[model samples]
Target: DQTSKTSYDLVVIGARWTGAVGEYWRSKTTYEVIKTIQPPVLVAIGEREQLKRFLVCTGGKEFIEQAVQFTGRLAAAVNASVTLLHVMAEPPAVYADMVRLEENVDQLLESKSELGTNLRRQKRELERLRVSADVRLRHGIVIDQVFEEAREGDYDLIVTGTSQARGLLRHYIMGDLTRSILNRAIVPVLVARAGPAKPGRTLWKAIKGLVRTR
Candidate 1:
C-alpha cells in the first residue's frame, strides 16, 4: 500500500546561523522548520497539497548542516526546497583593500597564499552545501537584504536568532538587528534564543554526574 504524502505546512526563513543553531540545540526534536507556515488543516483531504519552502540566510559555514537537516526532514514529509542566501556587508574600503591585495599577490606571496587558502576552504564548504540548494551571495546591509529577499521571494515565514539587548537605553529602544527584523517582517517570525546559556540545574547535574563517576 502506498502511503499518502502530507501536504506542505510551513516555510522557514533565516535558517543559516541562529535558526540552525537553535534547532540543533533545542531539546525538542519533532519541530520541522519549513519555508512557510500553512493552516494546520486544509479542506480537501486526499487531493489537498501545500508547497512549503525554506529560505536560509547565511554569511558563513556556521550552523549550515543543522539547517540542511531540518529542511531535509520537512521536505521528506512534504514537498519543499531550501534556498540559501549569503550576504557580504563588508564596507567598500574593505573591498578595495581586498582588490589591492589581490593585485599585489606576487609582492606579498606569503600573505596572499594564506588568503587564497582560506578563500578556497570557504568556497569548498559552500560548494559542498550548495549541491542541493539554491545559494547566492550579495553585498549589502543584512537586514535590508533579508527583507528585500523575503519580499521578492514571497516567503511566508522567517526564523532567526535573537540576542539579548544590552544597556538600559538600547534595550528600551530595541536598537538591534533582531528587533528591527522582527518589527518590520510582514510574515510570521520565529525568534530563537541566541544568548549564552544560563548557568542552571543542567550545570549542577553535570557536576553531580562527574562526581558519581569519579
Candidate 2:
C-alpha cells in the first residue's frame, strides 16, 4: 500500500459537526481515511491563527510518548508553548476505591504513581527537545475537561494519541476519544497512532461491513 511504501510527516483532514444528524447519514469517509492513514492526522476545524499554544492531552498510554515527542518537535519548530494535561476521570472498578481524582499537579508529580512518573518523564523529554511545557491536571469527563482546558488556555492546537481498535465497526459505532475530539473540536486536533500499520485487508473488510450495514 502507498501508506506502507511512503513515509509521511502528517496528514491534514477537515472536520465538521455531524452529531445532530443521524449516524446513517453521516459520511464514513473521514473516519475511514483517519483509520487507514499511519501518519499523525490533524483534523482542522473552525478558524485558526498562526500555530502557537498547544494543549497536549496525555493519558500515559503506549502512544503517549510518541504523541508527546511529535508535539514537542512541532512546538520546538514553532517556538510554541505546550501544556501537558491529564484528566482524572472516574477510575475503573479495579482501582475505584483507591484512586483519588482531586489531586493537584504538584501532588501528582511528587507522588510515585505511574501517572506521576510518566508526566514528569514527558515534561523532561519536552525540555530536552528545547520546548517549554507545563503539566496540568484535571478532573471529570475526559472530553469535557479537554474542551475546558483548550478554551481557558486559548490554545492554538490540541495534541492527542489513540490506541488501536480492531474493525471499522468499532470505530463507526463506538468512536474513539481522538475521533470524538476531532468531530467536536473548535480548534485543530493532532492525533498520532502508534503500532503496526493497519493492513489493507482490514480496510477492505471494514468497507465491506460498512456496505452490508448500510
Candidate 3:
C-alpha cells in the first residue's frame, strides 16, 4: 500500500516468454501483486554472461539507491566501466530557454547542479566498492536520450530505476520511461527497486548470484 512506510520499486512482472503486455496481463487474475513482493524479481532478455559496460539512466535524486548500488556491484564483479547519463527533458514553450537551431530544444535546467550532486553521491557510493565510472550530460526527451546513448555505447546493460508512484500520477510516471526503454533496448535493463537490503546486502547477493550463474 502507498501508505506504508516501507519503500520499494513497484514492478509488474509478466511472462518472460512474451513481450506483449496484453497477453502478460492475463497471466494472473490478480494484479495487486505488482505492489508487494518479498524478493526482487529479475528478468533479463539479453543473453550476455559477462558484463563489460553499462549505461545508467538517472533523474537527479529520483534515481533509486538500489539501482546505483546494484550497478556498482555488477561493475566491480566484472571489472566493467560505467557511464552515468542524465537527460534534461524539454521544457514548456512559455518559459522557453535557448534552443539549438538544428535540434529541438537545447538549454540548461541546472542539469549541472541537480545531476552534478547526484553524480558525486553515486560516485562516492561506487568508490566505497572501488568502482569508478564516467558521467555524461545530455538534453532531450529522457527515454529517447537514454536509448540513443545505449545504441552509441553498445553498453552491455542498461541499469535504471522506477519510482514508487501511486494512484493516477503513477500512470504518467512509472510505466512510460521504463517501458519505453524495455520495448526498444537490445540489452538487458535492470529495474532497481528501493528499500531494504541496503547497499552491502545488495552487493553480497549479486556476488553470490554471479558465482552461481557463472
**TM-score top scorer:** 2
Model with the higher lDDT, candidate 1 or 3: 3
Q: Name the candidate that leads on lDDT.
A: 2
List candidate 1 segments past 4 Å from native.
Answer: 1-51, 93-132, 162-175, 191-214
Q: How are the candidates ranked when ordered by lDDT, highest leading?
A: 2, 3, 1
- Backbone Cα, N, C clashes tallied per candidate: 9, 0, 0
Clashing pairs for predicted structure model 2, backbone only: none
Indicate the TM-score of model 2. 0.74
lDDT of 2 by residue, 42-65 (tens): 777666868889999888543468
Query: lDDT score of model 2?
Result: 0.75
Candidates 1 and 2: which is better by lDDT?
A: 2
Candidate 1's error at 116, in angstroms?
12
Query: How much lDDT does each candidate structure score?
Result: 0.44, 0.75, 0.60
Model 3 stretches astray by more than 4 angstroms: 1-35, 91-112, 165-173, 195-214
- Give a tens-digit lDDT track for model 1, residues 1-214: 0112544433223312235323212112112211112212111111113445545554333333433444445444555555555556656774787655554523333353643443334334434544334544455788898888877877654545423334442211112564555546545454432232234478889999999998
Clashing pairs in 1: 10-36, 11-34, 11-35, 11-36, 11-37, 12-34, 12-35, 35-53, 35-54
